[model samples]
Target: MRKHKIAVVPGDGVGPEVIAAGLEVLQAVAAADGGFAVESESFDWGSDRYRRLGRMMPEDGVETLRGFDAIYFGAVGDPEIPDHITLWELRLAICQGLDQYANVRPTRLLPGMQGPLRPELGEQIDWVIVRENSEGEYAGVGGRVHAGLPLETGIDVAVFTREGVARICRFACELARSRPRKRLTVVTKSNAQRHGMVFWDAVCREVLADFPDLDVDFKLVDAMAARMVTHPGDIDTVVATNLHADVLSDLASALTGSLGNGATANINPNAGVPSMFEPIHGSAFDITGKGIANPVGAFWTGAMMLEHLGEDAAAERLMKAVERVTENGPRTPDMGGQAGSADVTKAVLAAL
Candidate 1:
């Protein structure tokens, strides 16, 4: 049997709850499928760790996670802490340090979850948003206030590099080719951020030329947002920059239902750095211990991790089970049901 070592970081807020449920689902799948198993090592690494140690993960944190086959991450965010501090300290640290530069966030409507698409458009809404993870507007090239007291100004430079843009676009194109529809939509704001976005569009054009068979198109960020609401079926795949993709993907997920149904994978396939997979939603601290937080995002993210580990069959099975449970209409409070996260998790497990 092949054993895969997975680094598990159950992050903060309801992250641990969802992680527990997701691990349970993964275990169930392993029991049902032979010849493969997962060994997960829990890591106490997040905001709380930062508060105590006065830093995010240890300096050796990236190296510590290097040996794992993959990392199963729960959401990371706490109202009590400064968002950027924790984000850069942990999430962004692992990403840039480990060279996990391509973030693939998939937005698909679950069975009972409603979408902006009409009934005639399609039954299942599946789309992937490929984000340039390392550098873009998120590159952190800016200055804060107090530097010029008279001006009292702050500056944020939206940086974009050819290497970063080209790699992520190529990844998106490759992914599009494998999907049912060979289509890729490049989203940008060349109309506004001329230099940076124009560079991104040029990179997309260059990459699209390599994949001649794929149908490629570009949309301004604003139009893309509107179309996503009114014409989602028109899009099959989307690739965008860090900040733009971040906003659009969250909007896409919300269009399908709540933001809790999306999962993302931060990958650096060449480095052997274990990819980090997690739900796209933030930590819902309000529902922290209420048991009302949705675990669909976590479980679905686990499925993505399964596929990344080369267990596509198990991943598909888990997804089908999720679809079944949702179709049966046993939804969590966010989805307009009384069932808690545990109830939905068990229903999914039973279906599996």
Candidate 2:
């Protein structure tokens, strides 16, 4: 049987709870599939570790992950720690360190789920947001130099490069081509942020030319956000800068159902380095230890990881199981049902 080594990082808050549930469902699917196996090792690197070690993860963390076939990450955040410290030090560090440039988020309204479904739009939402993960607005540029002065200033440069734009455009175009709609929307705030966003627009136009088969269009980020609510069917696949897509995907998720059901894949796309998959919902501290945190996102994320590992059959089985649960099984509080995480897990396992 083929085996895939997975590094499971269940970071902070409700992360551990949902990760546990996801692993159980993953293992169940693996057993039922019968042709493959999943071997996962847990890494406890998060806010608690930071409090003790003065770091979210050890220095050699990314290198350690290199040995694994893929990384299965839970959310990372803490109420005590500054959000920036928690995000940049752990998740972003690993993502940038590993060069996972494409942040793919797939959003689809599950059947029989109550959500912000726009009945007037005349179509159920299905969107894959391809965020330029490694750079662009989130390139980690600029600083706060005058900390204590009257002229105290902080600057965060929304950096963009031809190389970054070209690569992400190509990746998004290819993904759009793979889908049945063959449609893609490139988003940038070029009219307002002239230099960086215009650079983004120009580079994307140049790169998209290579994808002749794809039906592509460009829109300002704000207008795109509006379109998402007013005309969701007009969108199928989207490519945007890190910050833009990060915000948009969350909106996409809420439109479909809940953040608890949103799945994300931080993909390297190259052969050697492993990609990382995680739920889009962060640590969700309020729900920590409550045993009611939703596990659907993590389960969906697990299925994405399986697909990335070339286990398409197993991935399909896992997704169908999740759909079965969503369609006619227990749901957590996030989905307006009385069930706990474990209950949903049980339903998914039974579905498997």
**Top-TM-score candidate index:** 2
Clashes of each: 0, 0
Query: Looking at model 2, how many pairs of residues clash?
Result: 0
Model 1 clashes, total count: 0
Encode model 1's per-residue lDDT on 1-352: one tens digit a residue. 8888999988888888889899999989887887689899998888889889888678898899999999998878888789998799888988888889888988777777775567554354578888889988899899888775887888889878888888889899999999989999999889988798888898889888999989988999999988887777889889988888889888878877777778889999785679999988787888989998888898889899999989999999999998898889578887878999889988988998
Put down candidate 2 lDDT per residue, 1-352, tens digits, no spaces. Answer: 9999999999999889989999998888889989889999999899999999999999999999999999999999999999999999999999999999999999888866766755655245888999999887788898998789999999888878788889999999999999999999999998999898889999998988788888889999999999998888899999999999999999988887789999999999899899999998889888889899989999999999999999999899989989999989688888879999989999888888
Question: What lDDT would each prediction earn against the true structure?
Answer: 0.86, 0.91
CA error at residue 166 for candidate 2, angstroms:
0.7
Q: For model 1, what is the alpha-carbon lDDT of residue 318? A: 91
Q: Return the TM-score for candidate 2, rounded to 2 decimals.
A: 0.98
